[model samples]
Target: MTKVQTAKDVIEQTKFFHRKLADFYDNLSDNVEKERVKILLEYMSRHHENLAAILDDYESEISERVLDTWFMFVNKKCDLSPFFSASINPDMTAQQVIEIAVDFDQCLLDTYEGILQNEISDEVRDVFRGLLEMEKNEKIKLAKNALKIDSM
Candidate 1:
């Protein structure tokens, strides 16, 4: 991946990644046979869509002043290429699907955490913090929902 430079660049990259995630979930929903699992995947897909939109709004609201400020890119393995290549078979259990989703969330959270470790302007830090919080909340929600689905 190309080296990220500014706060806006990071946000733009994240937004692109998130849109890809939304697409992944949508594809999973399409491939899954179980109605409940399908619904869950669709909900997650929508959640990712909302996340991308949120970042887009942030990018817009963050003035060029902060957006253009240089921020060091922390080299971390944040690629979702493995997920993109994953085969979503209809026979997979809801638990298995949830496991994959949770892993993906964790990977995202880790990436944001890595970003936080880097030197950045206060404005950029705040943006990253908000993104981190959102990821955390999403992970918790995913766990809870996964539990409900597992019990079904």
Candidate 2:
């Protein structure tokens, strides 16, 4: 509640970190790796439920341009995966690629928490909190299905 950072600042941080996470996934080269990234992306897409809540809380006076930018950031981040590179093609072992992705995901989650924990807004914080926890859970989910992905 310190009112140090503006809601705009909170919005921007979340936006920046979200894209970074997508780009991080988009950087992987191997086939298995891409699948891992894809899985993460799909997991993220499931987040619409939480994100809608935050978006609803934005000021009525805010311009659609701001919302558009934020939405694009979300869309890009949730859908990104580096495995699209025709060269990389995701061939690594499931265990290996997912581990790397998880590290970056953790960083993404931490950045989100750091920015969101501030007094910016509970609406914003709630979404970040869900994302942070989901990133942690994703590692486990991938691990559980490692063999399935590896065989593919």
What C-alpha lDDT do the candidate models reach, one value each?
A: 0.78, 0.47
Off by more than 4 A, model 1: 79-81
Task: State residue 33's C-alpha deviation in candidate 2, in Å.
Answer: 13
Clashing pairs in 1: none
**lDDT, residue 43, model 1:** 77
Cα lDDT of model 1 by residue, 1-152, tens digit: 32568777777877887898899889888888888788778877887899899888878888898888876656567555558677678876777777777767777787778878877777778888988898898789768977786677
Over the stretch 1-152, how does candidate 2's per-residue lDDT look in tens digits? 22343445555555555555445444443233455555643443333223434434543445544333221122113222433332344555445555555554555555555655454445555555655676567646645565455556
> Largest TM-score belongs to which candidate?
1
Q: Supply the global lDDT for candidate 2.
A: 0.47
TM values, all candidates: 0.86, 0.40
Quick one: best lDDT, which candidate? Answer: 1
lDDT at 41 for candidate 1? 80
* Runs in model 2 lying further than 4 Å from the true structure: 1-92
